[model samples]
Target: MRADAQRNRDHLLAVAGTIVVEEGVDVSMRDIARRAGVGLATLLRHFPTREALLEALLRTSFEELTARASALEASDAAREALVSWVRECVAWTTEYRGATELMAAAIDEPGSALHASCVTLRAAGARLLVRAQAAGEARGDLDGDDLFALIAMLAWAGDQPALAPRAEHLFDVVASAVLTGAGGR
Candidate 1:
């Protein structure tokens, strides 16, 4: 990773993100290379496959979510933080229409390209869940694994056209159930 190479790699990632968001994952590698101002060979050298490129792109989002979890726990009360984070997770995971199912599959299959990103997402959630449990705001019986499942389900529901309208209501219900001990609040 020399200075010039790093710069080119960063540019590729930036352009790739913009194009993917605007056009889609189906955008051609040649288009990405052209937009990135890099050679096709360079792009291929950096990301050998579409999945590799996508994995690199999604790493940033997963890192942001992890940082957000830490920030929420630092600033908010345990109950409030837990609820807020669940909403954030739902929105983040559903950012791409089909990302929820992709993430769910990645979570189960350790060898998937997105497995590391999924792990980070789950760990961020588990941290929130642990804090809520410690404060007795959430159920002690549940763990981060359970929280992850709930998040995946919520993301899937959020992306559905029919279910989208009911998504917020579903979140409220799920949050309430998780917060079995309101601590008399």
Candidate 2:
């Protein structure tokens, strides 16, 4: 793609992401085009359909999350590293608001672009969980699916502005319970 075309696509993705988080996935392409300061044709060229755009926006967030998770040094204190990574994931999900929902929807829809993007993050998180458990820093019984479920739940809870204040506390409680079997001191 040409530099200008790439710029236009980037702009569209940014604007579409904000709109999806703030408004919803139902927000029109025309609105995204307007927000991106681009024409409808340009928006369509970048993202042919609502699902395509939504998937692209969500894929971007998930890719970033995977990158962050992958960058975590496994050589560090396993428990601290796992906890820190989870907290960072929570923060990212909270900041992105509707990201969890988008991911869920994508997963539910077969052959989704977002579904492919999620695989790496899931694998990375599983690795972290396994390392933590093997080191006796986290509960051996806690599986990757459980951790993923917890993340989705917490992310959904954090989506509500009223519950936002307690998001960190909630994450801490969950992390402590999962890691220490009871709760962390």
Candidate 3:
């Protein structure tokens, strides 16, 4: 991409990020284009669909989270690593307001633009959960899918205005439930 085009794309992504945080993943393409001071055609040219735009906007952060999981995998404190990754996932999901819905949908739909990222993220968390379980720190009953559901549940709690105040407490509760032995870290 040319410098000017790259700048234009960056500007669009920045505006879209702000709108996504304020509104949600459901915000229209037209609204994003208008907010970015660009033609809808330009936005569409760069990102053919809403999913594509969201994938572009969210991909980097998702990649970073996955990498964080990989880094955490190296830690000997398996339970801590799993809890930390779960916390980070919930935090990131809440940041995008309605992203949990997208993630939930994407996980089951391989055709979706967000599918690969969502699957990779789930796998990363699963690896952590498995590590914790192997170390006899986390519950043996829970699997990767269960871990993902917990993340979505916690993120949903964080998204609700009423529940937002108790999100941290709920997180603690959920994290403790996931971990075993010394009552989790």
Give lDDT tens digits, candidate 3, residues 67-145. Answer: 9999999989998899889999999999999999999999999999999999999999999999999999999999999
Give me the runs in candidate 3 sitting further than 4 Å from their true place.
none
Residue 67 deviation, candidate 1, in Å?
1.6
Q: Report the poorest 10 consecutive residues by lDDT, candidate 1.
A: 176-185
Every model's Cα RMSD, please? 2.8, 2.3, 1.0
Q: What lDDT, from 0 to 1, does candidate 1 have? A: 0.83
lDDT of 3 at 28: 96
Cα lDDT tens digits, model 1, 6-100, are 88888899999888766666688999999887789999999998778888988888888889899998975988888888888888766665667
User: What lDDT score is found at residue 72 in candidate 2?
Assistant: 74
Score residue 171 of candidate 3 by CA lDDT: 98
TM-score, cand. 3 vs. native: 0.96
lDDT of 2 by residue, 1-185 (tens): 99988888888888887887678666889998988888999899889988788777777667777776667744576777778777777776766656777666655556776777766666778888888888777888877667776887888888887988898888878888888644461
The model with the greater lDDT, 2 or 3, is 3
After superposition, the stretches of candidate 2 with alpha carbons farther than 4 Å from their true spots are 108-110, 181-185
Candidate order by decreasing TM-score: 3, 2, 1
Which candidate leads the pack in lDDT? Answer: 3
The residue pairs found clashing in candidate 3 are none
Candidate 1: misplaced stretches above 4 Å?
22-40, 182-185
Total residue pair clashes for candidate 2:
0
